[model samples]
Target chain A: MRRITILGLTVLVTAAVLVAAPLLGLETIDPRQVAGGAGAGPEARIFWSLRVPRVMLGFLAGAALSVGGLTFQALFRNALATPYTLGVSSGAALGATLAIRLGAAFSLLGIPAVSLAAFAGALLAVALVYGLARARQGCSANIMLLAGVAVNFSFASLILLVHYTSDAAASFNILRWLMGRLDTVGPDEALRLLPLVAVGGFVALALHRELNLMSVDEELAVSRGVDVDRYRVILFVTTSVMVGGVVAACGPIGFVGMMVPHVCRLLIGPDHRWLGPMSLLAGGAFLVACDVLARLLAAPAELPVGVLTSLLGGPFFLWLLVGRRGAACSA
Target chain B: MDANRTLTPVLDLRHLRLELDGRSILDDVSLAVREGEHLAIVGPNGAGKTCLLKCVNRILRGWRGMISVNGVSIAAFSQRELGRLVAYVPQVGGRLTPFTARETVLMARYPHLTPFAAPGLRDQRYAEDALALTGIGALADRSLDTLSGGERQKVYLAAALAQDARLLLLDEPATFLDPRHRDDFRRVLRTVNRRKGVTVVEVTHDLNCAVLDADRIFALKDGRAAFCGPPEQFMVREVMHRVFDRAFLTVNHPTTGQPVILPEVGGP
Candidate 1:
């Protein structure tokens, strides 16, 4: 009954946010205008072309990141894990920064060259981290974590150097992209990330039992017949690609990856069976709600959704930790 | 005994050797257990008793040897395939994972069910049978965190049983249990061994329970196979002393009329 209630609440929140968030903005659109065909008026154009696409993109980014985050936490058996735990975000940031610094202008498949470059950077970081961890036989989750730290710091340094030498305007642009926003994202960006989220969500759902066993212990997982190493690699590579796509599309929208799964675990519990879908739904709704707040709180001058996420993530976790309502550990 | 000798061993290890960091963990160990046999492995700490079990289950690799379950090499089967043949219950010191006793047990049926497919009637029946066999059916819905150590160990046992494997490997399964729960656990294991016709191999610290329960005992000392035979041979003072490097006293239990081995408590 409790599981059903929590899952129902998640579905409700997702529905409410999907329906309500797009209708709200700097200029409110009539629901009937949106219900009318495209280009019925200016409101229709804004609704069809801008608000809906942005909310969809936000949903894609949140769902992908949260599922990825849940997978990493289970793989590493660490509650602090997030989609960015493996250096993908830093790599994407570096790629975008370098592109902005160099003024790369070759777009392919209708994708901005910057997005392509960010994706390339993300893959490079994952490859490097995976290679370093595989330097020895039987790569453990701890080894991969250390490898991620090494690559993340190195990529971060490179990004700093890129930012430090760039012109003022380009540096500001890079900084803004890093802070992440959904304001200008449209149908094209949403379409690009859809495959990634689909693939990531599929892998996570398929390995739900493995996720549950592994979170208990590696030995436990092995004894239960999980192809521990192979599955770990599969999960790692898939989530990296999905997260890379998300960061490329949304500029590493922060907190949804870390915070959503944590909060869902609190409301529901650690059974990955429910946790996987619930995390995806709650994550999407949470980010959209925050995106709405980002627009509304400052009206006419929008706060980047990334700024609000990080600003809120730390304090909310603190509250979850210190409040007497009591938070349970993943174990 | 002649008919048993003709049957293929349910578990067989041929000259297994494992070395880590320039030290031998298991040295040239070889043993075989027939189907339905209950074998106990006993040794002091670091004797590689648990390590031997780890090698069988593939949790610890880098060992040079051949291991076979039910006449097939361990290499021949995928991990999932092998899990259908051998279930391992590791020592009960694992993190209290937030699964209910039932969910944790049902995970044993994982290797059997297709991914994304709900448990069929047979799968549910197997889980229920395991729960009933281990007498944990009442605790099936209880979260692992809410379970006591003895209760949790029973949950692990139930999980292994639910795998419906032909053989079960346990590592110090009752270390956390008190005397009463330990007896209950032993009783459940005996039922699984005798009634279900499943082979059981376990590493144990309780010599008395081992002698009372196991059909045979395999003792390891300093990474070497020290002894293998019927418990009647193991209950002798000199054999026990040779393996443990300490003296022992043997006495017949007044109630059970069985030989019990006790360590020589007084100095030399």
Candidate 2:
């Protein structure tokens, strides 16, 4: 009952923020004027095109990343594990850099050329890790983790090499993209990402029980009727696609994945049934809150929401590590 | 040929061999267990007792042997089917998540639950019953990490009992218990065996506990079956000494007439 109450409160707060966030920009949006279409001018265009899309993008990206992060953490049984730990972010960055350097002009369907490249790159990286881990003694979590770390480092160095040789325009783009931002074209783009979040979120929540067992012990899970290998493969593919979409959409928003799940777990405990959906909801609200502060704090010049999240998350993460160490020592 | 057909053994393993990273863990081991029988596998450290149990639970794959449960090859059974037949209580616990004792025990219903379905009322009753059976009903709402060693041990046992499997595999279950808790555990095991007719296979280093509880004792030495018979045959000083590489003085318990081996030492 308490968990349900907490979830209800979180959802209420999230909905309130979702509605009020777009109105609190540099030019406050008057809902009455916009609703009746009487004063639907440049202010309306900015409200509909810029603020609404940006906030929705933030919410969807946050939700996808949080689900991805929670799944990865449970899959690896490591609290610090995140959605990008498997090199997807590095891969997306590399792809975006390559697109920038190549001066790609074609956009597939409605996705920007650079975002499409990024999505492709993230999938490629996951496929490589999966293949490498699967080829030798099955796709175990340890093998996947090690393979991902290796791939991440390799891609990181390659990205540096690209930055080293690229022109000033391309270099700036690469750096800006790597820093993470929620730059959306319009409401249509944000709406396009909703399906990915919805499907991925559903699949993740549905498998919460399996995640609960797997997090405890893989061998024990297997002994208790869980097909560990099959579940691991499904989780890998689901989280990869989810994280890939988020990275492509928002240029690898940092810390939303790691920080949100940790906070949710602390709030409701480690039962993934609650942890999964709560993290998704809380994560979306958190990013919206962060984006609001980002807009309000710097005023005309906007700080990247990702930067603020990292600044906040980094210290909390350190505090958590120190707190856990202290507890372990005392125990 | 006998007029009556022989009863099929509940468990049968033939010429089982397991090699891990170029090292032999179990070598040509074989055994058969009848229905409702309680068996104990005892040995020194590194004697492959746990390895044998792992093979039965199908945790360690790539073993060259035929393992049949009730005349059906274990290889043919899906992991879930195998789970319905066997419940394994590992020696060392995993990292404690924030699950209460009730929640932890309720996980034993995973095999019976449909995918994406929650545990039903029947499952909750089973979990509660298992907790009561293990005498940890009062601790059901407590977080598992907050429980003491003995309490945690009972929680694990309750979880396994809630599995409702026919075969129970325990690895050094009493390692963390005091004498009183150990007695309680033994009583619980006996009740489960007698009332539920569950076959039990325990790996332990305590021969006295084995002799007192098990109908048959299987002793392993260097990954081979050194002795497999009733406790009377296994009570021989030479058999005990050879398996453990130590001298033993045997005595019969006055009340139960069970054999007890005391290690021979020059002093103290």
What TM-score number comes out for model 1?
0.95
How would you encode candidate 1's per-residue C-alpha lDDT over B33-131 as one tens digit per residue? 999899999988999998899999888888998999878889898888888888999897778777889999988887898867756889889999999
Proportion of native contacts kept per candidate: 0.71, 0.66
For candidate 1, the chain B TM-score comes to: 0.96
Query: Which structure among the candidates has the greatest lDDT?
Result: 1
Off by over 4 Å in 1: A324-328, B1-6, B254-257, B266-268
Overlapping backbone residue pairs in candidate 1 total 0
Which pairs of residues collide in model 1?
none
Estimate how well candidate 1 is docked, as a DockQ score. 0.72
DockQ of each: 0.72, 0.55
**Residue-level lDDT tens digits of model 2 in A1-331:** 5888878888898899999998887778888656744248877777777888899989998888988998988888877666688888988989998998888979878788999999999999989887898798756777888899999999999999999999999899888888788867578778878888887888889998899988888878877878777788888787888889888878878888987888787677778888887999999989988898988899898888878989998998787678755222111
The list of candidate 2 runs beyond 4 A from truth reads A36-39, A135-140, A324-331, B1-6, B253-257, B266-268
Q: What is the lDDT of residue A16 in candidate 1?
A: 91
